[model samples]
Every structure is written in C-alpha cells, then in structure tokens.
Target: MSKKVMFLAHEGVGLGHIARTCKIANHLSEKNMCLVVTGSREAAWLLKRSVDFVKLPSLDGLITERARYLGTKLYFDRGDEKAIRFRKTLAEETARHFAPDIIFIDHTFTGKGGEYKDLLLRSGSEIFIVLRPVLGTREESVRHIFGNLGADLIPVLQPKVLVAGDARTSTSSDDVRSFFPTIPIEHVGYLAGPGERTNPSARPYNILCSSGSGFDGEVLSYAMCELAEKQPDISITLIVGPRGSNPPAAPPNVEVILETHSIHQQLERAQLVVCHGGYNSVIEAMSHHLPIVVFLGDGVDPIARDERRIHSRLLSSHYPLLVCEDVKELPQAIHSSRELPAADTYPNALVVNGLANIGNLVATASPAKASDFVVTPIDRTGDG
Candidate 1:
C-alpha cells in the first residue's frame, strides 16, 4: 500500500531546512506519495516540479533574519497572529484533503502552543512526526518553554516516530535526547549527498564560496581578494544565492555568479569549497570528497553561534574543514584546505539506512493508532 506522507517546511529563512526536507521527500517519494507544505515561495518554486508543495503566506525580509537571530526565542507577535491562523487553517485543510498516513515536520515544533499545535492536536488520528536536525541549545527561555510545549504536545498530537537527521557526532541529537528521552531517536546521517552532477568545469585550482542571501558581501569580497593576492594561480567562483541583495565585486581571478544552478556542477571540479558553515554546503562538499574552508561570520544572528559550534565540532573531528573567524585568516584557511589530500569522510551508508528505516517506520505505523506513542518536553534549563 502506498503510504501518504506530508512534509511541512517553514520558509523565510535560509534554504537549508527546506533543502534538507526536499532531499528527504525526494527519497521517500520513491516509495510513497509525499507532499511538502512550505512558506517560502523561492523554495517552493525551486522544488515545485520535484515534489508536491503547498504554499503558505510568504514571510520574507528582515522577519526571517530576525528569526535566525533569535534562534529558539520564537515568540508570536501580532505579525505572527495572521501566520498562526493561516497555518492552522492550512493544516486542517491539508489533513482533510490529503488524509495522510503520516505527517513530518521539518525543524518547526508543531505541537507546542502555536496555531499548528492546536491543529495537530485536533487532527485526531494522523501520526505526526517531528523531523529535526541534531539537537542543540538556544539562548532564549522561550525556547525551553516551547521545547516543553513540543514535548507535551507530541503525545497529544500522537507522533509514531521522531527522526533526527544528523551525524552520530552531532550535538543537536545530543540535545534532543537529553530533553526528550522518552521519544525514540532515529539517527539519520547528514541530509546532504552528492548532487545531480559529478563533473564540474575543468579548472585546475578553482575555489567555490557560497553566501546564502544574508552574508555581508563586502566582507566576503575582501577576504576573497586577499586569498587571490596570495594564491594568484587559483581561480575562485563566488556564488551569492538567488536572493542576495547586495553583492560586492570580485577580483580579476575570481568570478562572481549570482543565483546560478551551476553550484553542484561547479562543486564537482572545484579544488576546494569556501562557504558559510551551512549544513548543506559542508555536507555537499564532503559528499564530493572536497576539502572545505568554512567562514563562521559573527553577524547579528543566532545562527552565527550555531554555525560556529557546528564548525568547531567538524574541525575537532579532523575532517579537512578549516574554520575562519576574521577575513584576515581566510587566505590561510583556504590555502590549508586546498593543500589537504582529497578524501571522502562523509557517511553515505548511514544516510541510506536511516532513510530506509524512516520509510519502513512510516509504512508500518498506523495513522489511526494513537496510543502507541509517548511525548515529553525538552528541558531548556540544562546547560547544553
């Protein structure tokens, strides 16, 4: 029997979460029918053809930036009221029409006191699963509150499984297990994999750096210029995602491509990757067995700290990933990463097994069986 699955991805933030969800949905779609509901028009457009999508209200601009800044400090203000109502209505409508066998929520905790929480709780018999990144700590008290809300709401919402998409070494999973021990933790390895192409342009020594919409281009350009001055022989390709508002000019040896689909293609032949410590970029580079030079920009955002933490862990693991704090150090980092021998350290089998497990779990768990699940709140007070 074809199990009906709905994947809910929130928008107005970096494309990481949505991109990860899409990858999972694409894989799952092979065995079952999958639907993606997202608030990001850009992500929806990017994924519309590959997967079924339900577009919600667009929450673009600084609001998305603010959410990234605050981390778990998710608060519902007047602006959120309309979003809340819309999400609830949409959730209900989706449930009524799709009659999904299972519901998977990416990143967002739907069962907590939010509008979606009420809808999920009221949905009656559907198995609501929370698909999250490896767990981590947040600076906000509200995050704890919401964590508790999520923990409590899970039983009420009756999720048959909890899927944690991250490596075993991932701190995010540690945090999740610590908070919600009762919830079964299924570790799906890193969501990123070898993209569509294995061959990029034939360039002897080309570096690829990606700054998803939020990064300061001036800072990146300056750093790239410094690297170019030191390694004149190396060509660099800087990709500013489609939504990059202000891109800076690059040095002569460097090419700045705005919103190009050639990223994966480029990654195939690149000698090294210099990018923000986004999970997708790092994992994709690893998938291609390319060394990475991660720039953890400490801009006004909570994600900065998160990125720094993730990079720190990766560096500690001796994964040929160099973390650069200031632009002054970027040149050295790039040089160091390029010099390292190419090796594939990414765990490809782990990801495949996890996906298979999740598919089987979804297929076996009855949407009508609500009594087989347990939920608990994640304690926010603990020092993660």
Candidate 2:
C-alpha cells in the first residue's frame, strides 16, 4: 500500500532543513506518495519528479546581513505579520486537504513561530520530528522540543524524534535524552543529498572548497581564493553556493564555479575537502572517506553557529576532521589536513546508508520496531 508522507521543512537560514527532508522524500517516493510543504523555493527544484511539493510565504529573508554577521539575533520587522499569517493559513490548509498518514516535521517541533502547533494538536497523522545532529545549547534544544506543546497537546501528540545524523558522531543525542527521558529517539545515520554515491576512485582535484547555499560563506570562500593565490601548485575547485558569497578573483590553478546541480560529482575528484560545517557537506565528505577541514562561520543564528562548533568537535572523533574558527587559520588547517591519510579505516557505522535506514523505518510504520534498525558494519574493499 502507498502511504501519504507529508514533510514540513521550514527553511530558516540555509537549505539544511529542506535538503534533509527532500533526501528522505526522494528515497521514500519509490513506494510512497510524498509531499514536501516547505518555505524554500529550492525544494521544488531539488525534489524528484515522483514527489509533489508546495511552497509557502517564507521568512528566510527576514535575516539581515548584520544579523548573519553578528550571528545572535533574528528580527521580524513591522508588517511581516501579514506574510506570517498567510504562511500559517497555507500550511494548515495543505495539511487539512492532504490528510497524510505520516507527517515529518523538520528541525523544530511546532515549525517556525509555532505555525504548525495547531496542526500538531488537530491532525490525525502520525507525527515525527526530524532533527539535525548538532542542535545548540541544551536549553535551546529543550525549548524547540517542548516550547509549543501546551497541556492540551502534551500527552496526546506523542511524536517520535528522529536524528538525521548518527548518534555516535552527534552531540545532541545525550542532551536530548536527558531533557526528555521518555521521548522515543532514533538516530538514522547521515542523510546525504539525493544522488548516486560517488565512485570510490582517485580524485583529480587536490582540494574542493564548498559552503552550502553560500548565504554566509564570504569568509571561507574568500580565504580559499587567498590560499589558491599563495599555493600556485595546488589544484582547487571552489563552489560558492548559488546564494553564497563570491570571491572577486581566482588564480589559474583554482576553478571557481558559481553553482553546481550535482556536488557529489565534484566530490568524486577531490583529495581533500575544506568547507563550512554544513550537515550535508560534512556527511558527504565523510562518506567519501576524504580528509575534512571545517571552517565555522557565524551563520544564520547563534544556535546554528554553535552547532557547527559542536559538529566539528564531535565528528572529529570518528573521522580525520579538523576545525578552523577563523578564516585566517583555514590555510594552515588545510595544510595540516592534507598530510593526514584518508579515513578509509574510519568506522563504517552511520557514515553512509542513511537513505536505506530511514526508508526502512518509514516502511515499517512502527516506531517501536525501530530498535531493530541498528547500525550494521559495511565492507570497504574496493574504495581507495
């Protein structure tokens, strides 16, 4: 039987929310009717032909350049209520009509600004809250998890919590369990983007620098340009996301592409990976067993910014990962990372096959049975 799965992805700063949902939806779409209701215009463009999608009035533009630079506040100025209300109305209406069997709410429990709180209270759909690996402080995580759940919806709406990244490499799992002991939690491995896995072959590019959706990637991208200038012998491919900050110039050895539809193709040819610590980018790099250097920029919000710091610290335990807090340190970090061997011996648990694990859980349709979905070891025989 085909199940109706509705994914609510409220894209705030970057494409992480929608990108994760779309990856799950694309995998589930083969045997299910998947509908992705998101605030991201990029959702429809990224979704497969089988999956249906709808866009709502987005609050993504509310963050100003100063806010992104400061990485502290999120301001919704005057007259933004109209758009907010309209978005709320459209979201509610879509849920009512779709009447999905399963609703996967990305990141937040009640959606942005509690827009989906009413839906959680009224909808008959089985609810699931999908979370990223590294959520901010424990206090903020508690707020996002329980803030909008009033007395009325507390016992009634028992949604299963699913972490999109592996628990072994993620920092939020223990904190989340400590906050809500009884809440059912599942760590469903790294959900890389929708594409065939890159062939485990020798890559031609010496370094591949990428910042997801480049909304706040100015520092990293520009630093890479400077590195390219200093190291004329190194071959670098720089991808400043479509919405990302662009470097003014690049040396002959560095190839600067404005955007790419398939980043995995580029990943196949890279020897070392240097990028901002976005979930997708980090996971994909790990999947390829490449040496990773993450530059934690002040992105979108304080929580998001801190999450990168936590991400770099936690994930480094599992892979040959290095962190750079400032762009000034990036070149040296990259140099240090290059001498390290590929993480071919890195544990195979939770680094790849997230699409399969998540798909199995959805197919079972019973969260209790998720205990059987444990990490199985994989062979890395041919992968160089």
Candidate 3:
C-alpha cells in the first residue's frame, strides 16, 4: 500500500533545508507516494525523479540581508502581509487536494511569516517538524509546535518532531525536549543519504571544492581561484551551485560545475574535499571518509554563520578535519589536510544511516514495518 507523504521545505539563505528533505523523500519514495511542496528556487532541477515537486513563491528577494549577500535588490520587507497570505493560501490549497498521511515541515514552523502555522494546526494530517539546532529559539519552537490552543489538540493532531542530526554530537533533541517534553522527538542522524565510495589507490591526488547553493560562496570562489593560480600542477573541481552569482574566473586546471544532479560521481574521483561547513556537504564528505578542510565564511546572516561555526567545531573535535577561518590560511589548511590519511572505514563519531532512520518514521504511519529497509551501521576505528 502506498501512503501519501508531503514535505514542506521553506527556503532560507541556502539549499540545506530543501536538500535535507529531498534526501529523505528519495529514500521513502520506493515505499510511499512522496510530494514535496518547497519554496526553494532550485527545486525544479535539484530533486530526483523518484519524488514529485511543487514550487511556492520564493521569499529570497524579500530578505534584505540575503539580497545584499547575493547582490540583488529587495522590493519589500518581512511585514508584507499580502505575500504571506498568497504563500499560505497556495500551500493550504495544495494540502487540501493532496490529502497527505504525513506532513513534514522543515526548519521554520511559521513558513516565512505565519503561513504554515494555522494550516499545520487545523489540518487533520499527522504533523512532523524537521528541525536543526542553533537555528531558532526554544520559545519560538514551542509556539510553532504547540500554539496557544493548549493540550486540547494534542490527541487530535499528534504532532511530532524529527531532529535532523545525531544526538551524540548535537544537543538539538535534548534542547527540544526541555521545551516540549511530551512531544515525540527522534534524532534521525545527519539527514544525509549514503553515497558511493572509490578506492584510495585508484583516485587522483586532486581536490573538490564546493560552496552549497552558492548563496554565500564568494569567499570560497575567491580563495579557490587564488589556490588554483598558486598551485598550477594540482587539479581542482569547484561545484558552484545555481542560486548565486558566478564565481571568479578559474584557471585551466580548475573545472567548475555550475549545477549537477550527481555529486556522488564527483565524490568518486576526488582524493580531498574543501568546502563550507554546510550540513549536506560535510556529511557527504564524511560518509566517504574523505579528508575535509572546512573554509568557514563570515557571512551576513548570523544564524547561518553560527550554524557553520557550531557544526565545524563539533566535527573538528572527532573527525580528521581542520576548520580554517581565514582565506589566507586556506592554502596551508589544504596542504595539511591532504596529508591526513583516509579512514579504513566510516568514522563512528557520527551516524551516517540517516536515510534508513527516516524510512522507519514513514513506515510507522503505514501498515509496513521499516525494519525491512533499515540496516544498522557498524561502528569502527581507523585501525580496524
């Protein structure tokens, strides 16, 4: 039996939220009918064929700081009620027709401006919120999960939360519990899917550089260009995401992929990875046990900046990676990171079975048990 599951992923400064939802949707689509209603500008091409997609009016242009970061003009501010009403109506209308068995709201609960709050509360479907820590306040999360309606709607709606990180590294699950003790919260690992791995001996001694979504990838773009100029003998591939401005001119040795559906293919050949500390990028690199050098950018968005800072700090402690804050130090970081040996197997510091864990959550809603699809990952050290 195929159950209808809908995911609502509102766009932020980057594509992290939508990319996270898409990974889960792709995993569950084999057993369920998945429809993703997202506000991400790149949803049309970013999603896989297994999942269906619908795009909402983007709020990217309305965000002044984001607009400034992207070098675009802003027409309005957050108080535009007309924009809110339009998005709310569009999303609600889609939900009324789709009639999903489960609705997963990613990151922001209120949509851009109270768009999904009322829709989520009034809808009879099972509600699940996909949250990442250090993004929003607990008070706001409480308000979004359980509005002023008290415990009356708890039984009828039965809203739950799915934290998109591991409990061992992140305090998100504990943080959410302090606010809503009764709300069912599960740490579904890193919300990243498994990727292909290549043999260490067969791979080239090259570097793969990426800034997720390219929204704030300018710093990385500049640094890579300089690195390429300085290191002419080395080969570099830079993936510039579609949503932002074009990066600086690259040398012949640097290959720039503007957009692509298959990053796993690129991951297959690279010996090292240099990236911004986005969740998707880091987790994907870690799954391959590739030596990563994180170039932490100081951006205009405080929440996004803090997210990168915290995630990089947490990963650097356990994994074999270096977190470099300055672009000047990026070359040295890269040189040092390349010498770091690849782990014989996946690191046990974090859970990489996020796709399997999410499948279990969807199976709970249907007649089938997700255990049929879940595979428990083994924990091991580099020596073993």
Which is better, 2 or 3, measured by TM-score?
Answer: 2
lDDT of 2 by residue, 174-290 (tens): 777786677788887787544433343454447889878887788787788888888787878888887775577778888888777667777777877888788878877876667
lDDT of each: 0.60, 0.73, 0.71
Given candidate 1, what's the lDDT at residue 108?
59
lDDT of 1 by residue, 1-384 (tens): 677777777553567667766767877788778888777665554553547888765444213445665343434444554545545566667755676667777665662225456545654445544444433344342253246356677545545444444454455545554555665556655555545333433555888877765445446655776677677788888777765543454567877776764367778768778877776676677667667777766552465456456645644354667777777778777767656643544333335244556666767766543442222232234222
Candidate 2: residue 248 lDDT (0-100): 73
Residue ranges of candidate 1 with Cα displaced over 4 Å? 48-50, 61-79, 111-113, 124-148, 158-167, 195-202, 215-218, 315-318, 345-357, 367-384
| Consecutive 10-residue window with the lowest summed lDDT within model 3 | 370-379
Error of 3 at 380 (Å): 61
Per-residue accuracy of model 3 over 154-242 as CA lDDT, tens digit each: 55556677777776667566666686567787777776555566555653467889888887788888789788888887878898877
TM-score, model 1 to reference:
0.79
TM-score of each: 0.79, 0.85, 0.84
Q: Name the runs in model 2 displaced over 4 angstroms.
A: 61-80, 150-154, 193-205, 298-301, 366-384
> Which sequence of candidate numbers ranks them by lDDT, best first?
2, 3, 1
Off by over 4 Å in 3: 61-79, 133-158, 202-204, 344-349, 366-384
